[model samples]
Target: MRMLLNIRIPHEPFNAFVRDGTIEEVMAKIPEAMKPEAAYFTEQSGGRGAILVINPDEPSQTPAFAEPWFLTFNADCEFRVVLLPEDLQKAGLEMLGSKWK
Candidate 1:
């Protein structure tokens, strides 16, 4: 079964993760922005899995922009972790793994 986990990360830590390729590595690949406020998609582990990063701060002035973004994983056992800008650092990999399992 696939699950979605919501988390928060501080700005600095979040940026650091992005810089070190942690986020990209976990998500499998880079995300593509479908709508300004929706979300982005990426493949994880050389296409073994996938991830979707939903930007809560996406533009919401229009209905079209209110849609939630998503990332699709082609693998059978897959999950998505949606991290808010504030909870990145507070949420660790172990915690996520436990929650997912």
Candidate 2:
């Protein structure tokens, strides 16, 4: 399944890395390691943020993704299951709605 990885990096820690000139290396290294299908960076109200669409084989694999951010930047990471348009169509929503109704 495809999952969305929402990462929030706090300003203080992120700024420290920037000042130390480690941000470029650290930032580049993560995506290289994870090899996400898609990755995007943006700013969140709390700090810097990223949204990554990745495929992890099992539940045990969450740490493999989240730990890097946690230990590196004291970041917060959230994972949510995502469905493609085809996946939604195959979900049998109409069948479920009729069953429930």
Candidate 3:
């Protein structure tokens, strides 16, 4: 499944990491852990944030994808399943809607 990881880094740790220059070291590990198809960094809610798109082989891999960001930045993270247009087309929504009716 395609998953979106929303990461928000708190100010205290982010400031500390920046001061210590550990931010780059920590973030360099992200590719190895999440194997993200795409990633973007930006600001949100006046904090540092990132959006990562990844596909874990199984649900058990969730921790591996989330833990590094959590430990490094004390980040608040959310994982969401997302669909491509092809995935949406395969949902059988018409039949399900008719059944519900």
Candidate 4:
């Protein structure tokens, strides 16, 4: 089944992932956002912004709030994986299994 793995990593780690191509591997065949990598938007005053990783195949025609930059993941089924910043390393290790170096 296809899945969307949403991960939250520290700014440094996120940059490293992009540099090392880990992000590419995770999203499989999909297009990433342009510059500024991370997008931010506020729903209300004093509200924190969110980072969004979208699935390319699941397109929505309607206009929506902007923020949490959009990333498209080409997958066949619907799935969600949410990981916190601290769990990135462990989660990556698990995804790659023992063969990952």
Cα lDDT of all candidates, in order? 0.37, 0.92, 0.87, 0.36
Q: Which tens-of-lDDT digit does each residue in 8-30 have in candidate 2?
A: 98887889889999999999998
lDDT, model 1 = 0.37
Candidate 3 lDDT score at position 48: 86
RMSD of each: 15.2, 1.0, 1.2, 16.8
After superposition, the stretches of candidate 4 with alpha carbons farther than 4 Å from their true spots are 1-8, 27-101
Task: Score candidate 3 by TM-score against the native.
Answer: 0.92
Per-residue C-alpha lDDT of model 1 across residues 4-100, encoded as one tens digit per residue = 3222222444456578878666333322332223333344444322233333333342222112212222123223535565676766878899999
Worst 10 residues of 3 by lDDT: 26-35
- Which predicted model would earn the best TM-score? 2
Task: Enumerate residue pairs that collide in model 4.
Answer: 52-68, 56-73
Model 3, 1-101: lDDT tens per residue?
89999999888787887798986877787766667999999998988899999998889998898888888778888999999999999999999999999
Best by lDDT: 2
Poorest lDDT segment (10 consecutive residues) of candidate 1: 65-74
- Cα lDDT of candidate 4 equals 0.36
> What TM-score against the true fold does each predicted structure earn?
0.20, 0.94, 0.92, 0.20
Assess the local accuracy of residue 13 in candidate 1 as a C-alpha lDDT between 0 and 100.
Answer: 45
Candidates arranged by lDDT, highest first: 2, 3, 1, 4
- What global local distance difference test value does model 2 have? 0.92
